[model samples]
Target: MTNPLKKYGDARKERIDQLAAMSDGSVAVADAGTIEEAPGVSLIASAWRRLRRNPVFLTGLTITTLFIFLAVFARVIAPHDPAIGYLLDKVRPQSNPIPGPEPGFPLGADNVGRDFFSRLIVGSQQTLIVGVFATLFGLTGGLILGILAGATSGWVDSLVMRAVDVMLSIPSLLLALSISALAPRPSQWTLIIAIATVQVPVFARLLRGTMLQQRSSDHVLAARALGIKRSSIVFRHMVPNALGPVIVQATIVLATSIIDAAALSFLGLGNPDDRQPEWGQMLGQAQQFIYDDPHLAFYPAACIIIVALGFTLMGESLREALDPKSRR
Candidate 1:
């Protein structure tokens, strides 16, 4: 018969070996309770699972993806020069202001006699640039204001919020138009900056609200107790965790950015260069010939509407997916 003490010692050694095999100790924590259980699905991972199953999100993703592909491949895919009226002979006489679809030109001719199809294809690049850059600039501005207010709190938060409120009080479109009108001359950059300025208040307000919640979270409390620097607690801990809602808001803001950029261009505050085609500028130029050729105005208008719709749908679906209350 084996000694009882030796049997107990053997069992204990077996358990230790099993634990050593299972865990490499690669995942570190300041304390054992800091990570009591094994890692599970993260917030972003869980939200993505929901979003993939959402039809609204998929539809928007398809539309947005196709739009981006077109913009990126404009030069490669466009059959004709967007700036050149290469098929002037194909266009009907001055008796007809714009021509309908033909053999090579599917969308026919624009007001200036350029191939409307090529212009539409190429104009996507310009529209994409405006939407992305304006949103990025606005997001950067918002992040700055939000971080300052959310981390500092007290008087800083109040002052920042009040300023944001002042901006919000004015009509958003009107605010954008006022800024665009300030430029010495109309250009794509000017339009982007104007739209970005208008968007800053919305993003700042949303991020600040989210960040404020993170300030009192349990993890933050733990970090403080660990004697981490206040800056590290704010930037390293609080800021990263608080970005989920802000990311969701950015998607919605992208849709608005596109529409606002178009509106600015439509108002003759967009790029003045005829060499570079843009949907909004195309639509603006076509408005004069609406009765003579409604299709010209129709095409660009439809593109803007559809693109904006896609972003809105994606943003809404993503918001629902990320909402803690709706988690599956």
Candidate 2:
């Protein structure tokens, strides 16, 4: 008996070869000037070309770059040891524990007399770690669930979607708060886990929605007709096309993760060690002396706001740039 599948593949391959030969012959015969079209730019390259010209993107890029630089070089940037608080005895007074600017300390000291300037610089490190790791965790989990749901159309999709729906039902903040509160200890890892868990549903839904759209796309149908492996069709053809929105969402989620980490720290569920300074921890401590030393809260709050704004602006600019129909 003739192998039907093999015959079908061979027939398709022959047709493709003939088409390639015809295209080659046509190009050879055509005049150079007849091909008026410019060379095509890839999607990523085009998006980057657009982003380079956008001022909003440049501003956001600058802020985000500065923030990352501060985080990475905090040890070298901070003059004093954040944990030791050398200025403690010098800055502390009986009447007013936290003192204003002194010789060694430019921003003065925290409520506990730790060098506020040094602490603020180090705070960037903690914030970056938490925000980045949490967002990564969420993105990873979401990708897994999205792939599962998108690649298969049956009970598997329903099961994954149901689970995602369950997660989405709960308020994100509340879910994070609950998880943080339930942790055995208040630490950086705990905060990251809580925030990441809350973020999973958002990422999963976005990817899945895009994935479903890709499932019925013409390219996908053609890929199937070409007898490509199921895995290749899902990852190479479908997932890559579906990732644009998810990538934009991930950038915005970075800002949210930082805010959530700060909120958790502010609520006293964050790391208890003063040795490791965090903006939220600073705010929580400053709350006691907010009326007398409002600057304590002001500085850290400003850092948080600026960082969040930078990520949001960058994400928005990226989305606009990546959009095919955008005027830009």
Candidate 3:
């Protein structure tokens, strides 16, 4: 009461002393605006960080990488030429003796005595090529149609959407089957085109919806206000932003493409040359000997399953990374 200023000074000093007593590591102090915020990480980097922590993503990445490696180095990795069959082993009747894994042929011999391991390694190339190219063709066509529809209003949007709807009305495999059947020489190229055709409507619809949403976003509005050309805004701004979903979808579609290629091959629409050593063709050949040598079907089927699982896991993980809402 007698000296109020003295009491206030003592209280301030006590607080200061308390803070000073705290260890530097224990007490973190920063000016309001001067505190350093974390550096901005790019979306890809952030996604990668998150993916690294995920088991599903890791498994998928590993399998996919292994398959890609096999596809690229098929010749180098394969122990024997896929085309050369064991003529002596070919003489063994399916009923008398069914081959199992042995020296040189770790995965055993197929119905025609081809080295199962060698054919499998070589077959990866064909599967990957078909999946990749078919997806590319479909994606390109879809992007064009979707961008056109999304950038323009009125009749263009209606026409494009309607066409996509019509295509979607039919089953994808059935449509692909019909297309492949109609081709004059349903080779690998024809199969690719058929699978790609089925994929077009899927990508078109996805991009169209994505573009419609992005068309009115803040950045797009800003670009329009800045007198940016419509084409530039559409192609440069909207399309780029909308590609996240497309990329995820493309991964999933690739798995489907591989499966479809296999299916077409299984149905006798794949490569006519037996020497090509495709997984589906192998399965087709193994059908008759399923009872005697089920291992023949198991190998290719397992490969297909593993490859599809890899793509699926990767796609789902990517979807979770890209969309915050899905994280929950």
Candidate 4:
């Protein structure tokens, strides 16, 4: 019988010969083994690529993108006339047909005969505006106050922290309500201030804590030892490092701000003269139709709920994406 060792050596020699022939017989490889591929891109790039792999994230992103587009182009995208009132059609339920010869309204008409679909489209503008402004205001105020408190740890920190503590102790909604009630009718700016006020304490606390933790890190210490200006360390170095959490928090706060703004608007403080086509105003108007035509209220309520949910889901997805600890 043929020796097993001789057979193994022949197989190995054949493989080497095949490789040498492939390389034009110019070079010979004594031993060849499987080679592993090089490592992929950076963590962020890898994370992003992996994120695209997730169907849930993609679906959420698509929904959010569509909603944003709708909000941005409400006037163009709306099927019916948002402001035009159909004298013939009023209090039409969502499930009912349109107002015509066998007319069918996909979304139906409100108590005022306004197209529910159109109004809903316009309402997106209000939510986006409120969410964006409230977040900006909160982020701005938080950054300013947090930086001040964190950089200075003496009486300044104590004062700022105590103020934040006091604000935090109060119920955010209650505080907003009190301010809304006490203030004269609110303009857009007024509403922004009210929402920002509620959000500031939360952001301030978050940023302050983050700053405190980063203040003593090696990079910060090294910068200090290198004679880097304190301002440079705080703004350029520390703030950037601490921003991951801030971004996640901002997304969440944006969603909360939208909901809060809607609540306040529902209470009559939303639009100055109730002329604006805001979701909250629609909600307020919806209340009047509760006993009569429930559809008027339902349409707006559904829009608010849906938009709020979309924002919440987007925010949560953003958090998961940005937070390393949450990554698999």
Candidate 4 structure quality by residue, lDDT tens digits, 18-93: 8788886544474446475898687567767767877666766676687789889988887777777653454345
Q: Candidate 3 or 4, higher lDDT?
A: 3
The lDDT-based order of candidates, best leading, equals 2, 1, 3, 4
lDDT of each: 0.88, 0.90, 0.86, 0.77
Q: Which candidate is the best by lDDT?
A: 2
Off by over 4 Å in 3: 1-17, 21-35, 88-90, 93-101
Model 4 TM-score, 2 decimals: 0.80
| Ordered list by TM-score, greatest first | 3, 2, 1, 4
Candidate 1 vs 3: which has more TM-score? 3
RMSD list, candidates in order: 8.1, 12.1, 3.0, 5.6
Residues 208-288 of candidate 1 have per-residue lDDT tens digits of 888888988999999999999999999898899888888888899999999998888888999999689888888888888
Compared with the true structure, what per-residue lDDT tens digits does model 3 show for residues 83-169? 887734544673545466788878777656678889988998888888999999999988888888888899989999999999999
Q: Where's the lowest-lDDT run of ten residues in candidate 2?
A: 24-33
Model 3's TM-score against the true structure:
0.90
Better of 1 and 4 by TM-score: 1
Checking candidate 2 for backbone clashes, the offending pairs are none
Model 2, residue 43: C-alpha shift (Å): 1.4
